[model samples]
Structures are given as structure tokens and as C-alpha cells.
Target chain A: MQPVAPSLRRKPTVMSLLARFAWLPLCFVLVGCHIDMYDQPKYRPNRPSDFFEDGRSMRPPVENTVAMGSFEADSALFTGRLNGELAVDLPMELTADLLERGQTRYEAFCAPCHGLAGDGNGVIAYRGPLQVPTLHNDRLRTVAIGYYFDVITNGINRMYSYAHRIPPEDRWAVAAYVRALQLSQNVDADTLTAEERALLGGP
Target chain B: MSAQIFSRNANAILLVSIAAIVLLIVGIISALIGLYLSPWYTGVGDAIEQPVPFSHKHHVDQLMIDCRYCHSTVERVAHAGIPSTDTCMSCHSQIWTNSPLLQPVRDSYQTGEPVLWNRVYDLPDFVYFNHSVHVAKGIGCASCHGRIDQQHLTAKAQPLYMGWCLGCHRAPEEHIRPRDEVFNMAYEPQMMPIADRLALVQEYQIPVDGRLTHCYTCHR
Candidate 1:
């Protein structure tokens, strides 16, 4: 069957003209303007709001509730202390894997600031105003392994805290690595293993 | 008389309208698909303005400074952190203290306020990526960042879409490198033979499976 002629069809009225604009809104709709949860209403940290009584988005911890994973069973491992005194021994076994992990972590974290040899000559130290101390100093050599851990976890004078940067296990590994670095610098020929002594061109 | 006018050249008009409608529909569909897939929205290789005008091309390429010198916490933290104003003062305090190029940095130092750097590469809020994890797992900075040493003002080097992310996550062994080379921006994979590189991946213990391809690997 033939379609109706154009003249026979109804002419576009003001209503039809208005209906032609329906696609304008449909274009926006088709573009997917619906808000994903990613863009949902949110309070960023440090932003103040009238909704909260404190006018702060950041909330303080409850009076007595403990944080998850806050309870560390072994203070020696986490804080480098045993019986309220700095521990001399490592809490974990000294293995090649641990040292390898330590070396990688040290290169990534400390090498830029402390130098690979712990000689206080890292690129930042030589160039920056901050004076980094050597790990092989007489005082540091005498300090307990836990003392190093404490300084790294809490950050001593002129240093920032690595608590957020380094994990407890990695921190211990770093302490062990530092100990190894200290031992390497000031080796007594009398105390060397016979195999090691041979490598030093000794009889 | 009206019917005769309407009938005149009606076949030609119908054919033209039909063709025009088909072309419009095809164009719309193609445009929608292109918007989703194309690099136009990704802003790949487009230079972004930052507050300090710091140039990785100058620092990494010319000065030959290691990537970790500035982004020091990359291997230990989630974010490949921007160096602090104090970190900048380390060198610029003496060298270029009077230069106008470093005015913002000097201003930030004097006021004890952070120089708010304009971020070039941004992921969706839902995608939770950790720099430390990727660094430790043996993926080199070059794999995702492209040749950043060549960039004067950094831009998003890749599409950063879900499919683009999945492409690498699917076969990470292809991207994983030696741990020492993670911060080596100019490092090329072909430096070592293919067999040696593959062996390095296995030695590094990078999972050769879909563990990283899982949604939670990135989202969580």
C-alpha cells in the first residue's frame, strides 16, 4: 500500500515543534549523566562541614575502642624492645632471602637519603641542608639493634618517621642490614672466619 | 492538485531521507563507541601544567638523577610520592634560589606550605593502586609510565581504562623486570636476551597467572 501524501498528513503545530526538542534532553541522557558512586557526595579530609558538631570531617577515635591490628603481641618485633629494654638480637632468623629483601627495601627507601654504604653520603645528604649521620660511627656501633629499630620506627632528630613507610618486618630487616653494614666497615682480622680470611689475601 | 504536487519526485525524496537517517544513526553509534575507546578523553601525551614547572626530562635525562631521588618512597609506599618543598630546597636553595622559575618553590618554602603539584596521571576514584606493591612485584616504572625520561611536562602515557589495565594484568610476566631495574626509567627489556628476562621474572616470583587480573587486586 502507498503511504499517505505529505499534503494529506497533519502539519507540524507548536506542540509538535516543542516535541522535536525532546531529543535535546535525550542526548544528555544517552551520554550517561547518572552519577556513579565514585562521584557521590563525600567529605574530603581537612574539609569542614556544618552537618557535624565539630565542624570537621576528620573524626577522632572513640574513647575506648581499639583499632584493628593495633594490638601487637610481640613488642620486640614491632617496637624493638624486650622487658622494657632495647634488644640486641634480631627477632627473625637471618637468611639470604631476608637480606635480599632488606637490600631491595633499603635501596628503595633509605639509599637516596642514607647512601648504600651508610656513609651519610646519599645524593640528598650531599646536596640538601639536612646533615645525615653515618651508621658506622662509634656511637651507632655500640647502640643495641633495638635502638636502630626505634630510631627508624619513630625517627630521630632531623629524620622523618618511617612508621608509615616501612612495615615492621621490613624495619627489622633494615636493622639487620644496618648491623651487617656496620660489621662490614670495621672488621677485626683476628675475628674473621678462616674461609673469609683467605679471601683477604692472608695466609 | 495537492496530491499531484506531493507525488512529484516522492521516490527521490524518500530515498534521500532513508539514506540520511541511516547515516545519522551510524554516525551517532560510531561517535559514542569512539568516545569510550579513543585517546581524546585519556589525554595521552598531552602536557599538563604543574605549579613548579619541574621537568623530569631535565632531571632524569640530562642530570641523570635516579627516579628514586625525588619519588623516594615509591618502593615502600602506595603512592609514588611527590618530593616535598623541603626536598626541592635541598638543591635549589643554593643553585637556583634567585631564578624566577623556582619562585613558587621558594614561596612555598618561606611560608612552610606545600607546593600543590597538578597531578598528570589520574585514575578513577574506585581503582586503588599501590606503587609499592607493583615495585616490589617486579613491574618496572617504564611498563606503565612509558618513556617518562623524555617528558618535559608529564602526561598520561596510556589510556588508563579498565581494558588497558587488564591488558598488562593478564600477562604481567611480559612487563615484569629485575628489581634493580624498577626505577631505571630508560631501561630497555631487550638489553638482556628474552630467555634471561623470562628467567628473571620467574626468579622474582611474579605470579604468571590471573591473581593480579582479579578486580580486588586493583580495586581494593
Candidate 2:
């Protein structure tokens, strides 16, 4: 090869490099615009409750928010409907079928903490750290059906609402069963009649 | 010199063209195969057969019985569970006593065993699905489960996947109705117009965000 003159010789400098790669800047701009279209914050499902609303009450009302049925002045009967306005009517006689249904519901929803025999020594209460109240106590016996229902539905202190798990009718049935448990254990000796004593296999 | 430059340029262009053509062919073939085989591509299907041939078509369509009659827990539980043999015996013992079709159910009742009906419209095990909540909110069975009443063999009609559920959960008002009309599609239009329904969904703060895609909601 023949040697060229020094004045005619050229080199690949920064200006030449820029000229060769001029499309890079435009390419980056195009890609950036495409990504920006979809860069907005996405929608999230199952967001946790915002707990910082100090002005608004954290819990629902006590009376209107009973677990099962609330007593209404208009009708003299306990209604199972969610918002039905009906009066509380105590049953004249407790039925076996009602007790059976109540037992089933209680076992399914409450027995984990409130033991099968209405004692507070359930698996969750004994094994777990929580202290559940025994239904066999005198105080619990005096508690009204509506009050029991309210506690189950709204939860008193540490307990969460079983309303989502157990239906409204079943809650009433469970309450009825709790009442039956209280009656069976706390029956007064004075109230026992000759027929009752005979039925009880007494002298 | 001009001829040499023309030949080099032509050779480079030809090489690039061949590479581009090969990539195009491979991409097209793979895309087609993916579309056919992948559930992610085409959604879920219910081609798998159950142990017993339980026909929703016969039960729901021909007989005009409701879906809730058999899958009784839909309104109250997370699952719209398969009926126990006892539930079947409630009607089957008197109605289809001698029919050959009732043999499996009769056998189940006699043996104290339940039929393990194959789930067709099952979501991923992680999803916490409550039939009652959906039913209570006025979502129709047909909305996600498809036209199940028309399906004789109960094939899964829709892809009951996360995206599929989020589509409605994010904008429930559009699909919601009064408690009674929750299962009734016909009652939707009469209850509220689509625009009004969408507005109500927005107003009630119905979750539309895909955040429900969290692992615990469905998986747990």
C-alpha cells in the first residue's frame, strides 16, 4: 500500500462517533414514552381497613347490632331477618329439635372456645392463650338471649365477629341452646314439684 | 469502486433479511402453540371428567330446579359444595327410586359415602372464595360459572382465574343487584341500568383494584 500525505489522513474522533450513533437518543425517548403510559399506580384488591378515623366510631352500636334477633315493640315475636323489626317472645316450652339445632350450631361455631359441656375449658381456651368465659356460670345464665346473641355477633372484647361465619338464624339457635344449658344446670331445688321429682327419679 | 460498495451493501441487507425471516417464523409457530395449549393464553377449560356423571343440565334445565337446590351451601359458605348423598336421597329416593341413573346416589347412601364430584369451575386453591358474599351481593351464577344450567355435563365455561374474578370484584356495581336478584340475570336490567350500577359500585367503594391478587386471599 502507498503511504498517504499526512494532511489528507483522518481519524475517528468523538464528533464522528456522535454522528454514527445519533439514533440512540431518539430510540431512548421512544422507549421512555411507551413505558410511561403504563407506569401509573395499579388497583389493589383486599386493602386493609384504614383505622385512623378518630372522629368516626370504631365499633357499631350495641343494641341495634345484636348478633341475631333484636326485640321490636311492634310485633311480640323474635324475628330472624337481618333488619326485621319484631318483639322478643320467649318460647313457652323448649323443644328438643330446637336444642339439637342449637347444639349443632354451637359446636360448629363456639365449641372451639366454649367447651362441649358449656365449660370454658375448650381446646382453644385450654391450649390457646385466650381466657374464654364458661357458660356454666350464674352470671351467664341471667344474661338475656338478645345479649348473648349480641356478644356472639359483635364480639365483646378479644373475640371477632362470628357473624361472617354463622348465619343469623343459627346464631339465635345457638343462643337458645345456651339458655337451655343454663336452665339445665341452674334449676332451683325449690322449684322442683312432685311431678318433676318423680320424673327426676327422686323419692 | 462503486460496484464493490453496491455488492457489500447488498450482502449485508440480504444477511439481515434472512435473520429477520427466521425469527418471524419461529415467533409465529411458538405463539400459535402457546395459544392452543396454555391456560394462561386461552383461559381454563373443564374437559376433565368427574367420577360420576352428574348433569346440571338435567337437574337445572330440564327439571327447572335451582342450582342452590343441589349446591345448597352457595348462599352461606365459601364453597357451593357438592350435595351429600343424604341430600340426594331426600328427593331421589322417592322420585327416581327405580331409575338406573339413581344407582350411584343410592349406592352412596347405602354405603354412607359421598360422591366425589370433580370440581369444574375451581379457582386456584389460594383464592378465598365465598359463594354467600357473592350471592348476597347480587352476582348471578351465570356471570362467572357461565350458563351452568344449560351445561348438561357441567363443563367449566369461564376461566375462573384471578384476573377473571378481579374484573368483577373491582367493579361489582356493574354486576350487582338486590339480594333476591343476586342469582337472577334477568332481574339485573330492571334493578338498575349498567351506568347506574357502575356508579353504585363506585359509590359503595366496591374494590376494583387487583390488590386482591395477594396470595393469602385466595390461597389461605
**Candidate of highest lDDT:** 1
TM-score top scorer:
1
Docking class of 1: incorrect
* DockQ for each numbered candidate: 0.14, 0.02
- Per-residue lDDT of B112-207 in model 1, one digit per residue for the tens? 555666667766667777888888877888888999899898887887778877876776656767777887887776677778777876787767
Off by over 4 Å in 2: A1-203, B1-48, B185-191, B199-205, B208-220
| DockQ, Cα level, model 2 | 0.02
True contacts kept of each: 0.11, 0.00
* TM-score of decoy 1: 0.65
Instruction: For model 1 chain B, give the 10-residue run with minimal summed lDDT.
Output: B1-10
In model 1, what is the error at residue B171, expressed in angstroms? 3.9
lDDT per residue (tens digit) for residues A27-74 in model 2 = 988877644322323212212224524221223246546544444433
